[model samples]
Structure formats: C-alpha cells, structure tokens
Target: MSEFERIGPEPARLLMEQGATVVDIRDPHSFANGHITGAQHLDNNTLTAFVAGADRDQPLIVCCYHGNSSQPAAAYLADQGFARVFSLDGGYELWRQQFPEQIAQPDPHK
Candidate 1:
C-alpha cells in the first residue's frame, strides 16, 4: 500500500484471523512475559531474517509497548515492500486490556 495504517484491537483481530502476520517490536523479555498469541518478536537481531523470509504481499501488523514505537517500525516494514502494513493502535497495552484471553504467557519452565 506504500504506507502503514494505524488499526485498533478489533480490526487487528479480524486481520489476524484472516492470516495477517503479527510482529511484536518490544524487547525479548517483554515479549516473553506476554504478547499476542502467535506474535513473532522482532528486533534488530531478527529484522533481516524476518524481512528476507516474510511474505511481502501478506498483511502485517507491527506492535509495541504503547503504540508509539510501532508507527516507524510499521513504516519501515511498509518501505521494505509489505503490501499491507499496520500499527496496532494503543499497542500491546490496549490489546491486553481488551483481549486478555488472546495473550500468550511464556511457560516458566521454558
């Protein structure tokens, strides 16, 4: 689409159900603590491999702590050739609040 759009929890959930790839840009610890189910954590360490392997034409949703950081990250992914890029409005925080049942917590033993 050449640009990223900001989307709220409900719309993001719908897109996810339709096979959108969800990426969490928060730190590893934060991601491990709690994140959207099926979310892939992305950082500088994994960005290259992610971009190299991801389906550019598929919808992608970028998430962060409070929704601020994801804007630029979404933009970057859009620039990288993603056809539909979205930033989760209010980010993981709002998602957790609105859909706690959708959250995935890491197993302590893992």
Candidate 2:
C-alpha cells in the first residue's frame, strides 16, 4: 500500500547532500559507464538485497537511464519497508541535460 515519491533533480541533489544514499539501478556495465557520483550500483533485480544492507531510515533515491526502470524499483523498496524511497523524476538523461556538470557521461564504448 505504500507509494514511492518521485523527486526532481534539485531535491534529489539536496537529499544527497543530507546523506541519503543515491542508488543507480542501472546494470553494472551501465553503472560503470556512468552514474551519479557516490551512487551505489544495484541493478533492479538485486534491489531487495541492496536495501537490506542499507539504512532504511535514511532517504533512498533510485535512478536509471530514463526514470522508467526506477519507478518499479522505488515501489519495491517502499513495499520492503523503506520509509523514504524516491525515484528520480527524469533520471540521468534529464540530469545530463539540466546539469551537465553534475551528470556523468556514459562511456564511449557503451
């Protein structure tokens, strides 16, 4: 019955500043290619385990290539008892477009 909140880039950045764990739910290869600085990588499938080890009380922000992948991932985290699970509203692509300096560029090979 819990719902995940969608947060914009500014708020997401604020959350990160306040010690929230920003998780990149993209695949390992994609993650390695590029991701938010300090983001923990956990592909969507392994989200549950990742949450188990993380601090549930702290805010958790999930992001993917375009936000699609993060929706269900955030929902799943919310269902798993995470009090504050949030999905990046526009994902990395938007972040890149909006804040180029903050966005990590994908690897050329990828």
What is the Cα-based lDDT of residue 4 in candidate 1? 93
Task: Give lDDT for model 2.
Answer: 0.84
Q: Judge candidate 1 at residue 6 and give its lDDT.
A: 96
Cα displacement (angstroms), candidate 1, residue 88, comes to 0.2
Candidate 2: count of backbone clashes, pairs at least 3 residues apart or interchain:
0
TM-score of each: 0.96, 0.84
Which regions of candidate 2 are displaced past 4 Å? Answer: 44-48, 104-110
Candidate 2 lDDT tens digits, 1-110:
57889998899999988999888877788777777877888864776678678788999999998988899888988888888999998898787677777756565775
User: For residue 13, what is the lDDT in candidate 1?
Assistant: 100
Task: Supply the global lDDT for candidate 1.
Answer: 0.96
| Tens digits of lDDT, candidate 1, 1-110 | 25899999999999999999999999999999999999999999999999999999889999999899999999999989899999999999999999999999989898
Flag regions of model 1 displaced more than 4 Å. none
